[model samples]
Target: MMAATKRIALGAVVTALIAGLAGCSGLGTGGAGSAPGAGKESAPGAEGNSPAAAPKGAVNLIGDGSTAFTGAQPELPRAKRLKPGQKPPQFVVFSWDGAGEDSQKLFSHFRAVAKKYDAKMTYFLSGVYLLPEEKKELYNPPQHAAGRSDIGFNDTEGIRQTLAELRAAWLDGNEIGTHFNGHFCGPDGGVGTWSVEEWKSEISQAKAFVKSWKTNTPALKGEGPLPFDYDKELIGARTPCLEGQKNMVAAARTMGFRYDSSGVGNQVWPTKKDGIWDLPLQLVPVPGRAFETLSMDYNFMFNQSGTTQGDPDKHEYWGNQMRDGLLQAFDRAYSGNRAPLIIGNHFESWNGGTYMRAIEETIKTVCTKRDVQCVSFRQLADWLDAQDPATLARLGTLKVGQKPKPGWTAFLAGTAPGKAAVGPVPARPADQPAGKGPDGSGD
Candidate 1:
């Protein structure tokens, strides 16, 4: 999504400008080494490491982008077989559009909860966040923006800071994925309203941005931070506003994305005729707003007031729904229900202060108590692909009160740090003196 006028002279400025244009910004675990607690240790195929053969009887807990509500999946009947090898549903949490301090706070919040139970946190960032640090060449966007000051997008300085912090977190071990910028169906004037072509451009550009960082930058040199070390074309996404379009899916696959988390539990796979992996989010519903959207789950977690598009209420309600909804969903799913509990949130909706505190409360009540497995999308994918013959049939009758299988906790705790890199990673170029320069007054 670069401006057509001209390329920026300095990489950093151009990067920031581009971010301004894009309003850029910026998971879970599952399977054998799965569980909310599984995150404490390392798994072979997790993050960027080589895939280890999954052990027998491993169950993955999955989640999706930021969203959690009460009585959302009110009627999911259980699975039939409830077999040992079958993968459990996921809880994939997305970082709402682009990157910011909220992104970091959300990541930190998720990290705290996941770590408390040793669960993994899945993160998706906007490419704009990486521009100031990774694309710092004079020939980059920064130069162009510096020259014109307003020619491009991005808060070169702010994004730079966020990237530095994110890099550090990834090194500590986290799943960093891709959340498409300007593609989801957002509020009026939101990025989602962009044309299909613009949406395609957005997705491609974000992927390209990350790909460049993994290969072109010195700071990221060999550290293999997430979303980078793994598939150069990490194709996971949460549509803005959870809105899904047919053309968007086609564009995503074309751009080399392999997964889409926009689908809801009520919808089946291939719902759109495309072969894209439909990682539908399972959402809960608020008591009064049940009639609003018949498609996805109604969220009671956010108070039903205020000007927020998603929740009419501005009150932070994640704490109220976390336990009752999660336990109820788990009970329904384990008892052979086909419905998966899809929890979600926005960067602004669930970060720091009350939101963070609420999530922590939920973790203590739900994840730590039962067989919950907060998992990554890929981990869920792997588990789903390995289901036994009778597993699907047993969803409706699975029992509760059984001791969660052992071994995953050990795996989570036993994880060794991935490939070592020398020296500390770099700060955003905007922070460096190199970033201050002669205004690109033009040629």
Candidate 2:
């Protein structure tokens, strides 16, 4: 009798495994009238694990945010892809708001670091930073020092130079884009006493300035092989401060923007109100407080107070933490069929802290892990397009500026790969448009 019972139990276990793998799930079948085998399946929720779900992919791991505080993506190409057992992909970007000497140095450092990774960063420059002309004076007088630069603050010249550099970076396979002309909060909020309309003008001015650069630079001016591709020029942009959502989106579309990496973490698509794409920032973990809420503010780098400032002891500088958070978020997304993690940064922090160096080291370490790909914003946008049409369709239907839910954020926090499985593996073919191969280069 004992032997016969043992054989029956083995048969039942095999049957359950087969049924689970087959995805034999049902609705309203796990309650009072629950089926005999239904109770064994995992529960349903943001953190739930359905027995039928497919395994997550590793290459799907990602991080999004400003590279200015970290480094420039254009400089480093090899560091773009994350290999198996690697950390994550940190998509750093920039916001070119102030024309201070510190800001310029920050931008230069950003370019230098990105070169090391062969990645591209999205640069958001304001109109004031690129004024039509820097009203220079032959005589050095205190009169010209009123928010005016005796040195490099010419609107037109500054913007032209900035664009020229960005164009060069682009020619080298980097990325570029505009920040509103006025440096402020959303068009609704004022920045240093500027009004909404004034802010709008700043964005318009910045775009126009960039247009001129496209028409003037020898490498990028006309239809040239390296810099004159219409498709190439269409890929640059980040909001001034991720402000003026409605106005910024509408203006960018009117100005012919192809994609906008302004939003962070939250999945978005071209809005019905405006056709511009929203590349949201990735959710980065706070170094010491890896379980807290990720801040949406762009100035988190400038502010040294609170959790936004970051923890340096654990190598959790803003850049490291952000990148780590991004990896965790992407791991969660890959596991749950969600999208990539996005984060943004600025150049201000580069003036002092080890932001740039930290970012470079982190990228060198993380991007080569598992299936992570260190693509430019444009590349990411392209990969996004190649997603299953059904998935893209669902993404498209989502409204613009949809904030992440608390439950989802909590779920992402739980999936951090700190010494644990990084999660996911690239089952898709290498030539399938997302990444290269295990070598981190295209076949």
Candidate 3:
């Protein structure tokens, strides 16, 4: 179905996002403990879709390159232009915040799960994870003491392990976006109060952590560098505490960021803000309540238990609460309007590991279902961009949980002139199409 060419202004489409309304950044509920929320927060950050550059049999390296311009990233299936008259696939994005393979080993565990389901995820890597703890002082965060990080830095072994996972994850076609350094939140130097310059400083430092990990960490002196170029690879992020997004978006747009997942939204089609995609965390139906909850585990905990450690007896119930709510949210989009579902998580075993179980089960339950594509934010943005403006404008017309009247085929039956618009695919550096089996059998 070729699409119409209508466009809608963002302010008219996303009423949930109040301009200049502040909310706290960072959820601070993963790993060990949950911190108090910041006093303020706000919604906040293009065409993300570019085809994999097919390389011609060799690798190219940039100057002082900690990573190489490797051939087309393997294991990714080619995303074709959706044919006209076809319904959009149900896109479910499972993203991790403060991504690290810590003592819990959740990162590695989830990697295996994503592989089992042929799913791709976004890992928002906190830069300090790559930076050795001993070198913390090197990070000069704006407005704070040098080397100070709300999220603890890593040791050499941890860094090495994280690097290995990140390398493997990228090679497996996952995205590595920044979670920035120093997971600071709240009014006392929380990211909510940072200026555009400070946010830029934070971003630069985040990149510095990943790009210069080896230069700073002596133990990694001889080990292999990260697999991909950090400079060109990073294009999106989620702000800490979800605060300072008002300024973060401004800073990110200038840095070529393609998307930002910092605010809360209803289950609706996304639109642009600050010249990039504003893919916010959404509010989903709470299973047993009339009200909805944020599509994140920490928020569930915050509401249910007031912190990461909730009541032991209700842990199972809490897990089920999240699982059922996410599935409920999925059904509303899957069966109703066909809007994309964005879920955020951490690697911690919060509330007795119930949330982990919920996420894992959700993955197994949904990814294999018909018309479902568990993709990355980058992929989602690209898909949205490739679409016709009129089609998107029509999609935006369907409010939260509202189905297209007279059915999808009839609603999308009309086509304007021209070929079906296609999303941009990154040109690969290799001859073989990505995700081709090593044996040359596409299987």
Candidate 4:
């Protein structure tokens, strides 16, 4: 069994190393930036229903030539308003935190999976991953010393690999969002204590790293720029360990952000938080266990193995438990309220890589189902924006696992009782904090 003391020490080291970084001027990427379909008109032949053909347009290089405008991204589904009485399509957002390509090759591997399964996902790239360790001093975190990152920095080859994956992922209709830089969590100058301004600084640095990778990793300066303008592509993010959301949201609202997934919430239709769509991680069953936990791999591992590495013999069982639990959650939403199932994951191979297996299985099982749209958070947000406000309000009334009692036609035909002239649904009260595990260590 993994020792608790060792876990604690590791957590401390990670937290201490991940102090926030400083921002720099120039064309920077946006934090969890908005994806396409946020009210932008689609180009001809870019129907938004299917992935477009190879980007057809002159590649207009942006600042530092690290990213470019290659035209509307391919493979984005068109956001259409629901027909009268139409049952809303079930949306499942499979998003990765701190997305990067490393020796594990999970990023590229999943890109293939998404293509095979006809799904698109969101990749929240950590800024420091692109900033080589040699140029680490370029990062000046909010409260921590310069040149320090909990997750450390990447090498030129690592940056090149990550950039390639990012380029391909975006071309495949995936979103390139920011997980920010340094990943500072907990108290004591962690992200939780950051002011709105501090959050802004961190966000700026996150974008700067992406926009300036060509300058930082000079060895790979010949790399083609990332296809989309990150400032326009990023419109959302989940905070580090889900901390400091209050200030982060306040800062994000003004920084072109459209949504945030940094909170713990129920498996219900999402509502706006301070004008930003609050797409949070949901609570899902724990299989045989009576209680539910956040729909994340780390939470399940925390509840089962209690560490990144657990009993080898039980790895298969643990994997199945997580798979079954996620499927249960999917079934609940699929057959009932049809709330968009928001699932989060990391690329780490913790617990013998069982969670990765479970996630892949879950994707294979769910993405191919009829009427199920496995999409990125940006796509979900776009679909949400295309709906009639009253219809969405009516849909929100159904509780978790509670289907429309009167059938879809009647339930959403008109406004429900007591909800006159459906406007933006007021933000629901916060649910259990989902970012941290039982012991407060989570991805």
Tell me each candidate's TM-score: 0.54, 0.51, 0.82, 0.83
Quote the positional error of residue 309 for candidate 1 in Å.
Answer: 12
RMSD, one per candidate, in order = 19.3, 22.4, 13.0, 9.4
By summed lDDT, which 10 consecutive residues of candidate 1 come out lowest?
28-37
Q: How much does candidate 3 score in TM-score?
A: 0.82
Poorly placed runs, candidate 3 (over 4 Å): 1-57, 63-65, 415-443
**Candidate 1 off by > 4 Å:** 1-104, 132-157, 168-173, 183-198, 213-227, 230-233, 267-273, 287-303, 308-327, 334-339, 349-353, 388-443
Sort order, TM-score high to low = 4, 3, 1, 2
Preferred candidate (lDDT higher): 1 or 3:
3
Cα-lDDT of candidate 3: 0.71
Worst 10 residues of 3 by lDDT: 36-45
Q: How many Å off is the CA of 338 in candidate 1? A: 6.7
- Model 2's lDDT to the true fold? 0.36
Instruction: Give Cα-based local distance difference scores for all models.
Output: 0.38, 0.36, 0.71, 0.75
For candidate 1, write residues 1-443 as lDDT tens digits. Answer: 11111111222212211111111212110011111111222221223223332344332211220111111111111222223433444333323333333223554445545556645444666554454432433212211221121112233334334454454445444445665543323343344345566567566666655555434444444442332233332656765445544556777777656667765443121222376567665433222221111112123222222112333232334234333334444443433322334444444442123343444555555455344555555444434444442332232222221212332122122224332111222222222221111222110
Distance from true position, residue 321, model 3, in Å? Answer: 0.8
**Ten residues in sequence with the least summed lDDT for candidate 4:** 18-27
Candidate 4, residues 216-235: lDDT per residue as tens digits?
88888888898878888888
lDDT comparison, 3 vs 4, better candidate: 4
What tens digits encode model 2's per-residue C-alpha lDDT throughout 282-384? 3333333312222222323332233323444422344444444344444444333334444454443432344444555555654444444455555555444
